[model samples]
Target: MSLKVDKASMAFTFKGGMLPMTVMELTSADPERIRDQLAGKLNQSPAFFQHTPVVLSVEKLDEPHLSLERICAVCRAHKLLPVAVRGGAEPVKQSAWALGLGWFPPADGARSRTLEEVPTSDMPEESPAAAAPQAEAGAGRIYRGTVRSGQQVSAPEGDLVIIGAVNAGAEVLAAGSVHVYGALRGRALAGIHGDTRAGIFCRELRAELLSVAGNYKRLEDIDPQLLGTSVQVILSDAQLGITALD
Candidate 1:
């Protein structure tokens, strides 16, 4: 006559959200140097840099040395989308605003802490199946480029291939598969049209959120074992699985 009891812990459900933006500091003293850097990078990978969004950081610029207007014009001429300005002096900030660019303070305690300070455990994670279907069959565009933060690429016809890093705060949407040759530290959506067969492949798995069709998966729900040097994401039987690519 013995009594036994069993206890089971409940598994928590989480949703993945937007990845934070990666900062690219431009501290060159000479404007030509900055232009040359951009040109070299673009020349090396035209597809990767074309139409990518970027934030300008001018905190290091000396007074009357370089103007924000000039910087914005240079960025535009190089096909780089200037979306915001950060860590710049007052004049630079004002210039950015006048150029129709968004402005934000540098990542400080009063403003916002850097990504390192923010705990990863607190990030959002959700299943790809839970999202609302935003794509239709054979609807969307295919983009071959490096997706930086403040930039978004969407296709209604096919998949998207990013030859470079999908930095945080950037987004990639496709009606089919998504391939990232570089680190995927941003949000990527595949099978946007409810095609559960679409998948995502990345060289580095550091994305904030991953979604397929209407489902999504968050970071917290991801098993530590699945996070590795390379990863592949797939949806089968309405379930999303992250597995080693190799």
Candidate 2:
């Protein structure tokens, strides 16, 4: 007879998930040049690079040779962890394995779609990260229905206007701003592309998480007085400010 198994007692299980990861597209193969550019970016937005996991994308590089290790080192010095390499030749793939980094096919090599664009019957492996949803004819995207738990809506190009409540475990992200007509009980990330002037406005402020321009405040990190009130979250000089709408 087959033995009964308790799945909950299993020490490990593999599950698929969609996580946000930053892609560092490379145009040049010179490590020094990359270092110089990273230094400038660090100076402009220091918090944006704080131990962020990034994949080095070499699909656009025209050079025949790449100093992959040196580039990874430079990224580490700036607090950017190089977790993987995307799109490279056989030697490049071998080098990545030597460095213990995962390999991804070139963007053009694979016909992948963002999480929102994929249908249930036909889903492809996710790309490095979903390119934030673009604006339609220079205007933001609007959602008319409730965002149920575990669902995500993104308007990475402009503002995201939600006509209904964002349920617990839901998420909303935008490159410009996020405006919720109903209660915002889940997580909201505004200015995810580093737009410092972006803000988050909600009818009810019992959010599990709030972020602007990479600065985030969890529920515990928020002030007690701000809970259950209408509020706007703003980012100024890399600081997050949550103020009442009243």
Candidate 3:
């Protein structure tokens, strides 16, 4: 006799989600050097090392032995968990699997704009000399409604323009910039693809978190004077800076 199993009670469901992640790019593979540097950084900003999950980018290094375990230990000691590794050799990939960490290939900044050339012979005679504008990096994507709690919106290829409020617990990310026409109460992350030149502009700023490129600042780190005013967040000197927009 076989026991009956309920199909409705399928245990768990799978859904796709977008979460903010940090990347730790290793310039030097020395474990001691990494530990010392992390110590200095922690001293400067204690809140930054809060058991954050990060992906190790080893694209720049060509070391045969990366000391992956020692480096991971140092990061873990500093409250950083290595979730996976990106862009490394075959040995590094095997090492990652041995340590139960995921491995990924080298990823580009973002899906960049694509262009094609049409030969004059194949062109239509009625085709206009000046073509119409397109929705790309400059035009970007526009959202016409509010972003509620737990809702996430992203402009993966270009800018993001929101015409409504972003409630607390919500998140908005853009590859280029974020323009909020209404109140911004949730997290706003610009330059999700590592473009430091991107920025954030809001009509009323009271965001929970703001990040430009990989540099971020929480609510408590934000200036009190810029709480309810129109502001712009930018990356300056490798730090996130918020100032009233004139």
Candidate 4:
């Protein structure tokens, strides 16, 4: 008689939780240069990039035909795990997949914001840090330029604050909260680590996507009148709440 045995896979429950991830946006096709720069940056801030999970972003490059394998190799050499590739041409994406890489599109029309086109406002002077969302009171990444399409800024430790517009196809993610002093046209995700009190604040509520904690809402779900106006997004009872920030 044969005894039935239960497989270990059946006993495991795969629950999902959010974690901080780093994205290496490649503007050049030179693998050596990238490797060198990354090495230097890592040396300066060893703790920040130590064994960090990285995603390769090649959408902003003039030439997307970079050697995916070489990039991956360099990442592995420096203890950076390359898990996925986002925003590249079809051929480039295909090559990455062949090298055992996953493909992810820019979340909510995410695009890269270049320094050439910046937002200008005639409003009273306010520091970038002051414009940031105040939630868990911790150090947050202060971005000074526009968040363009396919560009993403993530503050894994605390919150994220942008002094300029977040154009369509861009994303700003934070572990605590997100604040934008200008138009928010892309995506903003707060409380990525599941803090229910996380929130999103923007000067102009033109976002295509917004999320607090695990609750999410698309542009269509928001009131049309709220567009292009100051707004705040929060999570209440596992639901997304939008309100004007007076």
Candidate 5:
């Protein structure tokens, strides 16, 4: 029994791909203020943010001299796990590395389109496309309550509208378009049947996932600034485009 050890060893492989992660942009150096704002945001949908992994962005900070540990601690207090820091100088990076926090390369703005640059005409038109087959004259669905976890609503006819929140773990699907008068924190799929011009609109753009036509975007891929803003999501050039509403 003392000499019966197996000699086979397992090999490890690494596969790389883009991951959508939440980015918490900091505009203030005060930890207390950060806590308060974060708390308010979490309150809107606690289950969604609870224990969520996030990356910190200091690009907007005027006095970015606060302790990195303090920032991470505040995030932890609000149930957000701070995994990395972005857009900081060498000193901040050094501190974050020392504290075992990962560093994320700053995103390039030149290659990306600004939210305002998106055209308003990109929104899914209520009327059917000239070349696409049309739905029944008035086929659509309207819901008036919070779509809780495990709940799903699908409108196979034309459109879907919810007057309440689409909570985390919930889902909404539509053949034409999806509109949510309240917060959208769950999954939304429009043009499920391949309507290339389909769209998704929501009062609060906090959805964990979104899709228009066949283009899909996860929470991390979305701009953090659009979290609480009224937004319209559309598919352009096979890419998901998000535009803030007036």
Candidate 6:
């Protein structure tokens, strides 16, 4: 007879926390009005709105007017998923629960405002009379956690932030800027689409390789003195430079 070995223990491994979901602030008084606005924006840039998941913030909406079913239906019509509801009145919270949507309270010290009260300048500017709209720089998201070896994080639409160590054999890729709050000993590639303006920030820079867009700097290319120091890497005038963080 053969003895049984505990092979299950060897096959299981624990990882860090779950990835955070993106939250979008609705900040609109009339759900129909906001829907129209979003539709118009998407019509102008269909590619930008496609496949982008978002949650709604209804703090700006009054308590008795809007219902959760109506909001979810509107979101579905726009191809946006309403995974969580935020910033609404008590009735709004109840409506969200009725519609099977998670209700998340606003963070502490966060200010609440009405749609009419909020300045519309924060919204993207629209063009008129055959004039073209200006292209805006893409926004980036930051993650504050350790990336273990054999782990990977990728951001295709925007930049990514990591506030933890990137252990050996781990990889991080972003289409925009990449900032690591801790050590970076793994591989990181930024500006994956030739943005060139993308950069890397780390407290301890000892990576095997670093790249921005198509340009790269290998470990052998950097000076030994620059290793293991807090630094910011940028591409200036087609050359990569490491500078001390202020």
Predictions: Cα RMSD each = 16.7, 7.9, 11.6, 13.9, 15.4, 14.2
Using Cα atoms with residue i matched to residue i, what is each candidate's TM-score against the true structure?
Answer: 0.45, 0.56, 0.48, 0.50, 0.48, 0.43
Candidate 3 TM-score to native: 0.48
Task: Tell me which of candidates 3 and 6 scores higher on TM-score.
Answer: 3
Candidate 2 residue-wise lDDT at 113: 32
> Candidate 4, residues 34-57: lDDT per residue as tens digits?
889988755433433446567888
Cα lDDT tens digits for candidate 2, 1-246: 999889888998789985556667788888999999999766544545658678888987765467889999999999999999988888888899899999998874323233455443443223211222323536577765566554677785889988777876577888789999888987788887788899999998888778888788878899999888889999766789999997
Over 126-202, each residue of candidate 6 has an lDDT whose tens digit, in order, gives 32311222222346665545565445566766878775677765667787878887888877777777778988888
Q: What is the C-alpha lDDT of each candidate?
A: 0.66, 0.77, 0.77, 0.74, 0.74, 0.66
- Writing each residue's lDDT as its tens digit, candidate 1 over 23-103 gives 446767466777889887554324334465777766555663456677667777888877887776777677777889888
* Model 6's TM-score against the true structure: 0.43
- Top TM-score hit: 2
Whose lDDT is higher: candidate 1's or candidate 2's?
2
Give the poorly placed runs of model 3, Cα more than 4 Å off: 1-7, 109-246
Local accuracy of candidate 5 as per-residue lDDT tens digits, 92-188: 8888789898987666654122222323354234323211221233688776556654456778779997776787767788888999988898888
129-236: candidate 3 lDDT, tens digit per residue: 212121334547776556655456778778998877777757788878999988898878888778899999999999888888868888899889899999999988
Between candidates 1 and 3, the one scoring higher on TM-score is: 3
Full candidate order by TM-score, most accurate first: 2, 4, 3, 5, 1, 6
Show model 1 residue runs off by greater than 4 Å: 1-145
lDDT at position 81, candidate 2: 95
Q: How many residue pairs collide in each prediction?
A: 28, 0, 0, 16, 1, 2
User: Model 6 lDDT vs. the true structure?
Assistant: 0.66
